[model samples]
Target: MRTQEGDKTVELFLSDEGDEVVIEVADQGCGVPEALREKIFEQGVSTRTDEPGEHGIGLYLIASYVGRCGGVITLEDNDPCGTLFSLFLPKVKKNDDRTINPIDR
Candidate 1:
């Protein structure tokens, strides 16, 4: 981690974008390495090595769920440090029959 606990902030932003919703989570920790950026979402891939049993499947699972829901997730470097995760999901709408439908892109 770049900043010690309580020294940095993790920010989240949400906004409505027409048919979709944008969600962003930005942290002020050690930024992800360039070499691992492309494969960060793959299972068994992770940056933290200090933990005894860190599986690194968290992001992979998240990606899987997002894909199934017809949403998209992306990882990027934060402003000065840390990592930023952005998720764009389709908005839910109610049909005339009262059924719930999540917009598909």
Candidate 2:
């Protein structure tokens, strides 16, 4: 969904979900299409065409980093308009001797 400049807004939310941290970014812009929703995080996939040779890779890198941190990423539709990107990242828990690795959990 395309929104007017006045309607453009980006909202961020961070929440503690027990063992994971929830990070959500919602933007009021041209939302991701249903057809591209699933592949939005894949490499070489992008909706922005205003720039030449500068498409994709962003979400791919984000997904890769999130995965390496033992986290998961999700895409959803924002209310009214736009796309919502959410990342559930594992919290770094510390033990008595040292900090525990998120991946080891």
Candidate 3:
């Protein structure tokens, strides 16, 4: 992870394990409070106004879309401070019968 400005840092990781691929985005900012952790994915829920045009839909949309793709999303504490978002996506191998219909969405 590399620090950007101030004490902020962002990190991304990707790995493949078994039948799924994992993606993690970690940030060293004000960590999500324990009280609001479960409600963070709700629409219009936000804690920080530091970023420009942060509509608070990123998590909500991520959860929604990941769910539609039969994947899982999780959040974890990033040690001293910050949050880690982990996304697990099931691989769709070639000739796989599982079809993802985006138009029906």
Q: How would you encode candidate 2's per-residue C-alpha lDDT over 1-105 as one tens digit per residue?
A: 335566466889999999999999999787888988889888889988676887888898888779887799999888888889999998875653433244331
- What's the distance in Å from true for residue 25, model 1? 0.4
Cα lDDT of model 1 by residue, 58-104, tens digit: 88888877776679999888988899999998877765343435434
**Superposed Cα deviation of residue 10, candidate 2 (Å):** 1.1
lDDT of 3 by residue, 1-105 (tens): 345546577899999999999999998878888887898888777766666776667788888778878999999999888899999999988888877555242
- The parts of candidate 2 lying over 4 Å away from their true place are 1-4, 95-105
Task: State the C-alpha lDDT per candidate.
Answer: 0.82, 0.83, 0.83
TM-score for each of the candidates: 0.79, 0.79, 0.79
Work out candidate 2's RMSD over C-alphas.
5.2
Go through the candidates in order and give the clash count of each. 1, 0, 0
How does model 1 fare in lDDT?
A: 0.82
